[model samples]
Target: MTIKPLVIALGLITGSVVLSACNSTNDNKTPITDTQNLAAQHSDAKPVVYQVFTRLFGNTNSNNIPWGTKEQNGVGKFADFTPKALSEIKAMGVSHVWYTGVLHHALVGDYTEYGIVLDDPDVVKGRAGSPYAVKDYYNVNPDLAVNPANRLAEFEALIARTHEAGMKVVIDIVPNHVARNYQSLSAPQGISDFGANDDTSVTYARDNNFYYVTGEDFSVPSSQDYQVLGGEPHPLADGQFTESPAKWTGNGARAAQPHIHDWYETVKVNYGVKPDGSYDFATLPAQYAQLDYRAHYAFWQDKKLPDSWYKFRDITYYWLDKGVDGFRYDMAEMVPVEFWSFLNASIKMKNPDAFLLAEVYNPTLYRAYIEQGKMDYLYDKVGLYDSLKALMQGKGTAQQVLDVHASVKDIAPHMLHFLENHDEQRIASPEFAGDANKGKPAMVVSHLLSQSPTLLYFAQSVGEDGSEMAGFGKPSRTSIFDYIGVPAHQAWMNQGKFDGALLSEEQKALRAYYQKLMNMASFSAIAQGELVSTPVTTRSGQSATNVIGFGRQSESQRLVVISNFDADAPQTVSVTLPAGWQGNAIDRLEQHGQVALNNNQLTVTLAPLASAVFELEN
Candidate 1:
């Protein structure tokens, strides 16, 4: 199946495209056929991912104590994601559920009774710890299990439940690094721990799992503002997280004592890339660019690749065998692109339709990662997210949004659009737009403006403000490092009922709106259509500065979307349609009265920070 580029042209409109009325009584309405809706009918539905920080999602306890233990603050369990909870998520039009923090990571918790060593507070980020610092790649987090001995069974049950709810499962795979004390207790019979067989005396080796500093001992970073477990005393918080022959920091800091700001809790993985920025392994020829994952997989089958490559490949296959749908690779660009080519191809060979998403920020490396790395999607962060964020904050214009789309039009379909994720500030936070309602229009534009997968952070619909001062992570972004209850999400959770009975009227309305928007964006004609930038002008023929317009046309439907970014003022704008389009514009959103087209243009009146989706029909 050939995926076409989502076209975003400037001032160029195509020939007349006709669309039947959504509620037409006429017998001559055009019927959607399998050929016309092939993308939706033949392939997987355009994915709408709901990323839940698993440790925090089902925690009904609201005792958000700072640096508190799980006994004090409470941790969410895998059993908490009941059938009802998953049903509610599926009803929100989520095709995929990314369960974050499922793996066993280094944390300041005592689980010695369960055969897990107590993680030193000096190396752990918070009481719960950072999920990125993975300690055991082969085991699930014991804290999330009702029975620690059956943690893997609990995770497998969650996967089965997610699939039963009609949603695919996605989990994080931090390929660039692992916990400073990396160990794999549940590895297969023949498999060994990451650095168990390595020669620590060397700085770099083709087969070494980690890079070493030879003679230097690892030292804990020094900081005055930050303290181990917020200055509270603990046995392992004695200013020492022991390591002989110091390894490189996760972010490539080679110092024995990395800076306080560095990713000190994690250590970088070695992929046969030497110190002077040179590949020690075989590089794929330029001709491989046009080849498929099968060819890439075959290319590496005979080559002597690095041992780390095979380790990650084995890890991915382990999860795939357990029915995991795909992975969300963290910091994919930090590792060599060749490694991705090797890893992702192996994934495709196992599951041809696997959904491979990566966190790659560099625009220059986007094509290399997607085309060569065989990635299905990459974060559209630096481009679309940044532009939309600026527009939402009133520091950017509608043109900036259009311009960014134009810049990445060639790879737009592979670029996933998101407004909120774990790493980003919540739209309702004071540091952001300061109101949940402000995200409404921006979301419409972000979701509908491209033919890409859409991501919604958990509780984004109900307006999670991320304002809790939960231990190491402060306000503005939800704490991935602490155990805390999300107030807005908990209100919607309503004590595991999965119903919004306790939510405010405004939050309920916002959630309803999100449901409608997500459904339309995911399963409607907009999901697999060509996006054309529609020219917008005021009634007086001047460009509407704050209003952006675009058209999504599939064989089955034609839609004109107009959004007003102005927070305090309504705007009356005219949207120019294609030359031969003659129809009555029925407002799909808000259901204002039918808009009449005059001289190949449809005039719209939008409220402050409002959006309209006008479905045109004869």
Candidate 2:
């Protein structure tokens, strides 16, 4: 909506990638009359997301003990998110900051000094617990606060600071489950804890917050050598925790003692689902799929909702009231889609533009989650991300990226794309691409492949290999369960200046490339452009399967993006431009020389694992 001339100026200074002037005639801006108008506003400005594990983002401590106490391996605090740090993040072209692990979760820390009871080590995952195993919905994690008693206030200050830096805030809302000891010490008056009013006599109840296994006490799993806190001697690590009438594990394990592989630290929340997985509540009508959130909220207003539904509704409202812009639901597919309809509808009614993203891996359920559940976006992990990963590892081809895009073409705009996240392996890891630069080509394609938001993990920009040998978190991922400092990212932190002052030359180049690509993608032309596939064909050269090409176009601007997937081979490929798309080529990614078009066809040779984004206009 706020079209600026700066994009055109930047484009000119950077070789004028496309020939069209940045300023567009009002005549060419067609009015959107449908609900898509709300979505279109997003297209005009590209969304760059920087995800940070709040506990690790600002921790300058390099003493990374695998299973050490918070004292041994320091933790990051809300106070660490200084204005200067946030400014640097914003300067990196980020629109949203996903502060992971901001909520109160069951952890191994002893907070008894602050009037909070100690978390049993047996039930907690590691020194820093899994953020997904939320314990208190109303309070911030005590570990993240500079003053343990002022944790919530500290979090609020961070939110205010993030907004001041022109970035929206996104926090996790793990709907599928909660810590086995589901107690909220800071719940607002008149609110009750989960299962407080439930009848434990029955195995299943329509209003029960959790499913019960009658006559059984909770017991620890027998197999697997893994232990809480890595088997460090502790008074609470005696392999026992108390739970009367054991509940089902988060992963739907019904056994009194779940297997070691099961999510033993958390218990699944029942959302009006019967023991047999049948719905016990009314579902949204098929006609409600296209309705706005207000309508969906109205439809459920007069209806009798489940207890679990009201609890989640209250939780989300609490955050929204605290200036939280949106939520990223964890393992959302495990919860029924109907519950999401109610939950998301309530949030949207309060804030119409709230960003609601969910992790739903079932490709079969992507559409249902987006349309029926009224979600803004769903992870395209199984589609776009998987295809790209395979192609990067030489196990697949560029044709697969095209195929995956075609499969999700109808919903492409609603799908969020990312090459790295806390859940995925780092692209630079030995198990992955084995080099940092390999991510360049993949990033160019991923960000420009569609008109959707792109996410980058905390250390991803600096080429953090994510290789670590920790007690809880597996190697090849930045440790989310342990108190660990990311070496590459810490260098960028540079003792709180956050200017990447200590980064290596290659690391600096990688970060610069990301900034350029992200800034280029932020231009209205690429952000709001309609996607067009311009497949490359090998002509009069050695045939190779290492190239991929595509284009995006607005009424006045067009950009052609091509990348060589092979790390060892330079590729030569040809693409025929659409009629009326003519201009001197400008390499938008690196601001290099032009590649002229002849007979409406253009050919380019790229260095190994290199990419090009060329702008074209008549």
Candidate 3:
């Protein structure tokens, strides 16, 4: 499993859009036609991503001490995702299992005997540490293993288990930044740590792994009211974490002492991008936007890229060889799109069907990242997620969802939808809708609105409120930074049985609803169908602002979906069907009486925060 580092010297390489046809070199590649492309695009079931915060998923420890140690809180191991658990997750119609925080990260734990270096408390976020602050790229987190020495093997077994359960494995790859004390103890013999060969005298070098703040020693940021371990005493809590010639913070903060709000625990990786916002590497030609990943990979084959680019690419290959299916790139927009074009092209060359999902928030950059950067999917955070959140909080109307969907309709299939993730506030939280039921209609819209992947955070079904004041992570979001137990998720775990024996009736019903919706959403018609937004109006002909109507049509199926956002009142609305849509509407969700249609319009009544999927039968 050894990867030889790219030994290209520093040199400027210009890129051109190769408009010429792909060379017929016998590289064992098969030419794909237009029909094949379309068929390949929709060949599989809709990807239902189940994102589980790895360490917290199976942790049965009810002792959720704020900023508690792994010992006190009892951290879950990679072994906890047993066969039963994977089967249960697969039963939810999940196509992918995102094992978040699988990488070795800077954590407040002692593994000195295992030859792992101790991370200073000042730089570490919580007891378990922020998963994004990756300390090593070549190894799994020791805290996640039953035996620290066999951590990587344990993770490999987990990957196998996930695959055996008929689900793909997705892990995080924080390419934009890494831990402030980045040290890859498990790196292969030839691979060197980042900044090892760097000329730190200059602020920005073309090949330097990180941007150095020359002549300035790094200083720990002012914590203000926040204490390093909740004011608890520890040897490393002496307010001193050393780094000479400080590198820029992960958020691109150039200060020697970054603000407390800045991502001070991690340092940004330089991908041939200068501090003046100029690219140090060759920028992809605008014409290259129309090219495929293979062409993109061919273009960069001869070009000398930045060392950081090779490093991340090699890291990706390392995981791919480990049988890990795909990656969820963090803060992908922060990295240069050109770099993605090169790296993702290389990934595609190795594994064409690899699932590449990224966290890209800018609506303007969506097309570039997807079409040019070769990303399979990007987070629909700023667009659909924000609109849905506002609607749930009573601050917006259902029209906003339609508008947001319309804005990115061209690339809707590449936009991944989600109501909750590790970063977002839980729907059951006081700061959010404060009721799990409020997410029903939103989930319906998110899942069925487009031909895109849907991410379901762990315990989102049983309604985890995320109300615990878990150290650095405040209420409303599950604590990714600390060692804590998720009550709702634990109830479903049922002591490793992976059954919901301990769940309340409401919780049980919510889980069942999620399972049903997920399975239905996986259907070929709803998953890969073309969507047509239908008009919805009240009986009096006024726009039904609280209701949204849309139709998903395929060669084999035609379905109409309507959701009521209003949480207090039931609304009867007239949905104008697509032209030439003539059929009996059968309720797929509730199996209610047939919906009557008059003059191409169907009238339906929906309770507050309820949704219906009507299968149009000819």
The count of residue-pair clashes in candidate 1 stands at 0
lDDT of 1 at 276: 69
Model 3: per-residue Cα lDDT over 434-487, one tens digit each? 999999999999998887789999999999999887788578999999999999
Tell me model 2's lDDT, rounded to 2 decimals: 0.80
List, residue by residue over 1-618, the lDDT tens digit for candidate 2: 001111000000101111122221111232211236335536657677789999998788888778877787788999989999999888878888999999999888888887777888788777788888888999999999989999999999999999999999999998878999778889999999988998887888989998888999999887567766776798888889899999888877788898777788888788888876567777778767677677778888888878999999999999999999999988787777778888988998888778888887767677677767787878889888999999899998888777777766656667789999988889999998889888888999888876678888888889999876656867888888878888998999998988889999999999998888877757655677777767588866543466888778876778888999988978788877677667677887874468888877778988888899988646
TM-score of 3: 0.94
The number of the candidate with the highest lDDT is: 3
lDDT of 1 by residue, 188-212 (tens): 8898888888899899888998888
RMSD of 3: 6.4
RMSD of 1: 7.8
- lDDT of every model, 2 decimals: 0.83, 0.80, 0.84
Error of 1 at 340 (Å): 0.8
User: Can you list the residue pairs that collide in candidate 3?
Assistant: none
